[model samples]
Target: MIRALALTLTLAPAGMAGAFELGFPVDCTLGETCFIQNYFDHDTGPGMQDFTCGPLTYDGHDGTDIRLPTTAWMEAGVAIHPVAPGRVKGLRDGMPDIAKDDPAAPALNGRDCGNGVVIDHGGGWETQYCHMKFGTVTVKAGDQVGRKTVLGKIGLSGNTVFPHLHLAVRKNGVEVDPFTPDAPTTCSAAPDPTTDLWEDPIPYDSFGFLDAGITDAAPDYAAVKAGLPPRLEFAPDTPALVIWAFFFGAKAGDVLTLRLKGPEETVVDQAVTIDRTQAQAMQFTGRKLRGSWPLGDYVGTLILTRDGVALEQRTLSATVK
Candidate 1:
């Protein structure tokens, strides 16, 4: 029951931009990717707002949730990096990376942030990295960290259904939108100030314009909400593979397409027209390949378009044997 509204783009005067610049916190290449799972919320009980005043965030969310596609990726050691140069301000560790289903997990509380590190960059700026893998906090309090410094490995050590690093940036103790630190608060003026945050900010579209990937099987968000891992990667000799793509801030009149191209052929191609706008929607298509299965790379692509304009297009690949 979502509806699209005409997009209104805004940019603050160049004179009002911030002096600070940041970097992305994770290291990814090629087949590996990262995306914003949740964004800093700007609204109260009625609705939600992300740094971009987009629907990528949830109500009450106070930080950016940068995420990997699977916990297996987290377990294999995806290092979490600091976005700015700073000195470690606080450090906490030793929380086991336990799933919520494990009764042994610590009672959710202040512990919800789990093993993490907070770095204070002078001039009243600070950044906090939460949900780090247990025992992977490499920097102790007062340690100096440079941009992209490896502080820890990402993990599910706290109150989260997914494995990610919850990055909270603050200015003099007040939460700030890294994307629009120069303009007024997003709660006040959205379309987030055009003032970019990163030294070379990766625009929202570059990373998320299309948040998509291949799953070991079909994901039922119902099960995902019930504490189940929604994604699984394609395994060697598996019976089948599911391709799911998620489009964010999709408006009416947009056409969504999901395609699966195997080693030798186009296995599945599905498309649906958005009758109304949606904050996010998952479109999935899968196949049980015949014979012994392909022995090379399988690619999945998702493309979204509106009135012949390409809004977002991305592709992910999985090597299978």
Candidate 2:
């Protein structure tokens, strides 16, 4: 479902130089408000690898995916900007923002990019911004624009199940990885940034937490994907106490530990090992209330570890009233 639109675009030329310094395409800060959900696939065969030789991408992925934490953030609005100055080449708008799997979703019919914008940077260089919100496109075809121009807002249009900007770059009409113009023929050394496109360095993260919270019951995966509402106070008669986390860049064998500490004592301490790699994942652990939870505060901690070393830890607190 991803990048199916990009694969159909006609190529420019093969050997043109892709020398250009690009800026961050999304408005939010990386690793905090937004994250790189996918990178350009580097492997040539029927396999997948990112610039870092990591599993952050899928086979045939042609762009870097910058994703907001949830649909709620999409509703609040997050803008998408061009990486460089150019004339708006072409654009499409008015696509409904619906999940790919939703029963009412429209047929792709090569409209997979869904309400996106294309900018011509000259010299056979151009960029595409896809999956943008309906009615938020501020620029029109043939309009002059720059990095500061707000093209549109991130959305769940096209073949996406989540809100994100699927950004693809081309030189001479041929797809190229902005992080590294030439995809690695072999996954070996780390990516060399000197020849990359970004004006400032975007750190390569292997894994991190997207969101975490304390809830009164086991989290609903679909609701979590939509975005969990913040709640810090719970009734004493709550059915259970749960701590849940949403994360990305997971690898097989990674160990996740979820611990909940009540006012006077430690309540639940649980560890789970990931058996498969996932682009985004959710996990949770908690205890059901017997009569009523102790009237005090509870802290839930989530620690994700790899190779026996802790990689990231997030804590959420809740109070019983």
lDDT of each: 0.69, 0.86
Q: Please write out the lDDT profile of model 2 over residues 1-321, one tens digit for every residue.
A: 344444333332333323677899888999999999998887766788888888998988888999999999999999999999999999999999999899999997888899899999987789999999988999999999999999999998998888999999988766777777754344545766676778898988889888889988888999998888998999988998888899998899999999999897777999999999999999998888887788898888999999999988888888998
TM-score of 2: 0.93
lDDT of 1: 0.69
Q: TM-score of predicted model 1? A: 0.69
For residues 40-117, what per-residue lDDT tens digits would candidate 1 score against the true structure?
665544577666665667666667777766566777788888888999999899988886667787786667788899
Question: What is the clash count for each candidate, in the order shown?
Answer: 1, 3
TM-score of each predicted structure versus truth: 0.69, 0.93
